[model samples]
Structures are given as structure tokens and as C-alpha cells.
Target: MMIKAIQLLVAVFGVLNLNGIECRKSRILNSFEYTAINCRVHSASIVDFGGVGDGKTDNTKAFQKAVNHLRQYASDGGAQLFVPAGKWLTGSFNLTSHFTLYLQRDALLLASQDVKTWPVVSPLPSYGHGRDAAGGRYISLIFGTNLTDVVITGANGTIDGQGVLWWQQFHKKKLKYTRPYLIEIMHSDKIQISNLTFVNSPSWNVHPVYSSNIIIQGITILAPVTSPNTDGINPDSCTNTRIEDTYIVSGDDCIAVKSGWDEYGIRYGMPTKHLIIRKLTCTSPYSAAIALGSEMSGGIQDVRAQDITAIHTESGVRIKTAIGRGGYVKNVYVKGMNLHTMKWVFWITGNYGSHADTHYDPKALPEIEGINFRDVVAENVTMAGRMQGISGDTFTGICISNVTIGMAKKGKKYPWGCEDVKGISSGVVPRPCNLLVDQGEGIVGMCDIPADSSAIDAMELKKCSYIG
Candidate 1:
């Protein structure tokens, strides 16, 4: 029955019959030519404060040696710096253009905890800023800057952050230590990261910031869901990106696509576009499996997500923008999804706010438009769904077809089968909004709204099966 359903859905949608098999074929290879790949690194492990090996635990020599080699080799083309297996402890190593850090499945890159050994960069407002004024800890376990044609791939081993100390400090003050992410990419292009176990991050796990043409595939990320600000894959101000065949169990959004600040978008003056997310599975300390912007001040559009599976997540598909996020999200295609367990099945809210309540600006909020959902199946949805549509202009050009929702639970008794949504979350319980129910047989339309709304323009449910 499941196979028959899938075939019927594919026939109805006319898209992606391959089921994401093509992605596995295109793993990052050394053949692609990009300037960032030509870096050379020091042969020995670095252990120094300022290039002086202090014996105690200084990786400065090793890190600086790799950086200097990169300055020479990266310009010619990229090259892989072989870090043989075993514990290669380091403070912080800067990433150069066109370089690959290939680990041999059994390798472990452990990080040092002593704060003084690490270096600091300029302050950014979005993350844990103003808390680490005397910045000493590394911001990323593996970091890259202004790079291209970079690949970090290996079948074995793990990059351990040893985050217990950092986690304790963050909980006590929430500002004293701003631990670096597990893997970070900033202002670079043509990046590919695959096949690594990124575990126990002090902060966000893998952050790709201000980059383009990026691919993050086939990684297993494990961070305690209770860990604060530990998002799995955060693509900030990026374009032409793809994330596939990965599994994430994190503290925050499994995959979040965002722009810049209220005016931060203007700071970079570039929006995120052309994103494709496929064959990914997620578990939570996570709020949403795949979310688009509370920080969409720079706008995010032309995104395609398919073949996603979520288990024990907060929400299945969420698009959250706020009054402060002034961008657009359109041309999205989400299909071939299998989701089980969660608070909400689908939620689209236009209200955005940071956890700290700082940096409040109204200019960031933009009208959300141009979204599509096709061939998605869900089981055991706790909360119905919330769609705000467009503020003054209705959420138009939106389509939900070939969706098979199993059940809606309401305690032990009086369980509602399925509910349709069409309403703005503004103060007055404005009548249930407009939701079209069309070509959907067996799919019942429950008109619980006592008042009237223009939200639902059509309702068609034909040749379908529903059980209440």
C-alpha cells in the first residue's frame, strides 16, 4: 500500500522520480578545480604559544605552520592536509582556501580547554556577544575563512569539542565563554563537507556563514538536546547550497536558513538563495526539522527540500519570520517526506524574536510569500497547524496536495481527525481564516469557525481515503 501510494503521488507531482540517488554519486572529489585547495601544512603537530613549543600543551606552532603553508599553496589550487589517525590535540587552527582535512575513519581531533591558548576574532552581534569581551576561547573547533573548493571528508573518527567545561560556564553566566562551533565557513565558496562525526560542540555544531556553493552531506551530528544554542546546521547569508544524507540530534533547529540582522542584511547586502535539502533525518532538542529564518532580514527564496525524515522533533515543517524580518521566502518545493512524532505538523508564523530580547527592530519583518508543499506524509501530530499567510496580502500561490496525515491526538478521547487552517494570529479571534479543501475525497472539512473568513478560497478533496 505504501509503495502504491508513493507511485501515485509521484505520478501526480511529476518531479524527482530518482529519490535523491544522484546526490550519493556526486561526493566531493579532488578533481574539481578551485583556488582554495592548494594549501600546504607543517608536517609536525603544533604545540606552542607563539611558535615556541612550550611542552605543556601549546598547538600554536602546528596551527601557525599550517596557516603559513596555506598562504603559499592555497593560491595555486587546493590540497588535502593529511592528519593521520590518533589524538591530534590543538588549540585553534585557521582554515585557508582550497584545503581538505581528510580524517581516516578512526582519527580523533580533540580540542584543548585552556582558554588562553586560543585566539579571538572581531565581535558579532547575533550570537553570544558582549559576554566574551576578553575573548580567549576558539570560536570554532574547525574553522574556515574566505575559502573555496574546500572539502573535509573521511569515513572514520570524530571531532570532539570536550564541551562539558564550556557548557558549565555557559549555563553559569551565559556570556563568559563563547565556544567556537564544530565546523564554520565564512565568506567562502564551493565548499563541501562530508562523512565526519561532529560531537559535543560548545555552541552551534556546524555553521556555514556568508558563503555560497556549499554542500554538507553524510555526517552524523550528536549534541545534547539540552545544550543551549547548539543548532545542527545553520546556513547564515549563503546561496546555492545543498545538505543531504545527514542525521542530526541537536539542541535547536536541525537545519535553519537565515539572512542577516535587521540592517545586517544591508551590512552584507546579500540574501540566501537556491538551497536544496534532501535525504536528511533529524531528531531534536530540536524545535523544527527544517526552518527558514527568524533572521531573514536578508531574504531567503528559491529553496527545494525533499526526502526528509523526522523522528521525535518539535515540528515537521516550519517557516518562521517576524515583524523585524524584512525578507521574502518563495519558490519552495517540499516532497517525499516521512515524519513521526511531534508537537505540530506544520506551522508558518510571521512573528520573530530573539531569546535575549536585545536588538529589537521592526524593519526586519517582511511579507512571507510563494511556498508549496506536495506529497508529504505524517503520523501522530499533536498541534494542528498555523499559517499566517501574508500580512495585508493573503498567503497566495500556496498549494498542499497529496498529503496523507494519519491522526491528530487530543488526550485519550475526542480526538479530532484532521483540521484545516486559515487565520491570522492577531488579537481578536478573527474567524478561522480561508483554507482551500479541493480534490481531496475522504478528507473532511471541519468548519469550527463560528465567524466568517476569506482565508479559504477553495476546498477540493476527491478520490481520497480518510478515517475519523
Candidate 2:
């Protein structure tokens, strides 16, 4: 009888162990299934479709043909187009859904400098006219619309926009329409752009507008300090996006988050929400390391950024908007930021850029609330903070905690400037402007604001596997 009891006990324990193994297997299987659903198995090479990367050959037709040929595989298992090492000159080209454009290490994709190569497309309906002028705009060099599961990635390949000509035209007032961006993904979902180097973009470097589920990582963008409007990685009207591990030396804001421009944005009514930005290093002597608005009217909410380092940047965190912008910027939380030689560590301006048109109502007032900055350290800062808000619509719920800033020897005469804002300050060095109420002593240095859990959960992204 004792022997029989021992056997039964062994059998029961064996069943429990099997149950544990099954649970672990289920988790592993779920992870693998998720990756398989997003993975692309089809592959092809650009050279197969008569692509010549000799720096002089216009590969526009070749690229179009290759993409067209790969459309057949989209329904099967998606396709990847591999670009070998060489300088490839091409104009604007459209990307299909479930497509991947992968560049080899030594490859340089050069945008054609000829004006005729770029076609003029209609301005965004949100912005009644082109941003620079009053007509259609030039299409982006690498443009996509209504595409899903599209990725522009490589082993740190380069895309040279050769934008000196466009910059000269803009400076000379010789352009008829707004300049084109280097990469613009519009109305798309499940987009990934990673491991690429962008140089000399005509306008913004990477713009993901009206899109969702975007992941931009391990990108290096470089532009001249004097270049115009070369903002890096603008996520406009996008949701559930993650931008991380990016290094930018930009002419404008290193990372500008926007919804739309003034009245047009108000009518379009799409908000940029649930964005996660981390591990970004930037140098923008002429602009902010990260800026919001000045064109935000549709609304911006639930933005969380951390682990940022800014060197020689004009402003660390800037919020720009005017009275005509009728949107709300709320629940922005930033932490773990380090800045050196910045004009202002924190800046919020009520009167900044002009509205897109006269249709914007002057009295439409923007709402700025729940802006939190914590665990920030700055050295050689010209000014600690400059907070400005509209008179009647004073920016409310602004919180600054655990911030320490060391002023430069020749820093601004006033370390802190405040106009019409209301908030609380805790454990901030150099004190703060009188505008912010001191929220006791022990409450300082503690971050009670919960992070956006949804954005954090989306960070479990898998890297693309290349078969070429």
C-alpha cells in the first residue's frame, strides 16, 4: 500500500510539472505568433529590376518597376526590396503596403536635384494651402500613402537629399510651393523606420502623419545649422508611436510634435496621442531639443519622454502656440533629461509663430495643462525657465519637480521669467519664478505622476529580420 501511495504521489507531481511547462510554452508560443504575424518572408533585390546605382543613372523607373513586380507577393507574405551599395539617384516614388525597403551598409540613396523630377501634389486639407506658399506642394522624396506594415530600414545606410538647391530657392524667394520632406509616411499603420542615416533634407527628415503603430529607432539625422525647416522626426497626428535611440544634429527642433496648423488643424480634428520618446541625443543650436505646437491645433495629449540629452541646444523643452490655436496640450511628462549650454531649460510661449491663414480666429485660445518636468539636470543654462501663457487662459497644472540647473557666467539677467501661468514647483534649484507656488519641502523630488502604461506596453517591438 505504501508503494502504491508513492506511485500516485509521483504521478500527481508529474502532472503539476507538466502544467507549469504548458503555461511557459503558451507564453513563448504567443510571443512567436505575434512576431510571425508582423514578419515579412518575401524578398527581392533592386538590381533584379534593372536598377543601376552608379550615382548618375536615374533609377526612378527601375524602382517603380521593382515595387510593381513585388506587389504580387504582398498577398502571399509581403516583400522586401534590397538596395545594394552605391549612390542611387531617384525622384519621388510611392511605396506599397506590406513592403520593406532595405539599404545595404555602403549604399547612398541620393534625391534628384532637378526640379522637374519632383511632382507637385496638393497641400494637406488640414492646411488650406502649402506651408510656404499658396499652392500645391512638392511631394516627398520617399512618399507613401495608405500603406500598412511598411518599413524603411537598413544597416545604417545613408539617404542624401542634396537639398542645397531647395534651400537656395527658399532663401531667394524663388519657390512656388512648400519644400518637400525626405521621408513622409501618411495614412499608414504598423510602420517602422530604423537604422538609417539622413542628411540634407529639404524640410523635415521623417514625418509620420495620420498614422498609427510607428516605431522609429536607431536613426541618425544630420543637417547644416543654417538649413531651413529641417525638423527631425515630426509625429503629426499620429498615435501609439515610439521614437527611441535617435541622434540628431538638426537646423530646427530635433523632435517636433504637432497635430496640424492653426484653423486647418482644428477642422481636421485629429490629435497626436500616446507617444513615447526615449534615449534621444540632440544638438540644435538654433532650435529646441523637443518642441510641441506652434502648429498644434488638433490637440496633443499623453506624451512621455525620458532619457534625453541635449548639447548646445537653444531650448531643451519648448511649447509654442498662439491665441489662434484652439487645441489642448495636456498630460506631457518628461524625466531623466540632461542639458548643457542651453538658452532656456524650459520654455513655453503663447505668442510664437504666425497662423497659417487669416481664417484662424484670434480669440480661439489654446489650452495648456498638466505639463510635468521632473528629474532634469542642466549645466551652463542661460535661463532656468521662461513660462508664458495667454492672459485669460493661464496655463494651469504646470508641475516642475527635482530640477537642478546651473546658470552660465554670462547667463540671462533674469534666471526665471513668468508671465501668465500657474503651477507648483518642488525642489527646483535657483528657486523658480514667482509664478509657480512652492509645494512644501518633502513633496519635492518625488514623481507621483504615473507613466502612460499603454505607451510603455507598446515598447515590446520586435526587430525586422532581413532575408536578403
Quick one: best lDDT, which candidate?
2
lDDT of 2 by residue, 299-389 (tens): 9998889999999999999999998999989999899899999999999999986778778988789999999998999999999999999
Report how far residue 240 has shifted in candidate 2, in Å: 0.6
Give all TM-scores, in the order shown: 0.74, 0.90
Which ranges in model 2 have alpha carbons more than 4 Å from their true place? 1-37, 444-449, 463-465
Residue 238 error, candidate 2, Å: 0.6
Per residue, candidate 1 scores C-alpha lDDT tens digits across 1-468 of 322343343345442223321111122211221222123232111111122222244554565565555455555543454443446667667777656666654567777787666566654434323223334445676777877667776654588777777788777875444677778888888777777888887777888878887778788888888877677888887877878889988887889887765554535556777777889899983588898876666778777777989988888778876665566776666766788877765677765555223454554447566566655677776654566644553545555555665554452132222222332221111111345335333332221111222111121111211110
RMSD of every prediction: 15.3, 12.8
**What is model 2's C-alpha RMSD?**
12.8
lDDT, candidate 1, equals 0.61
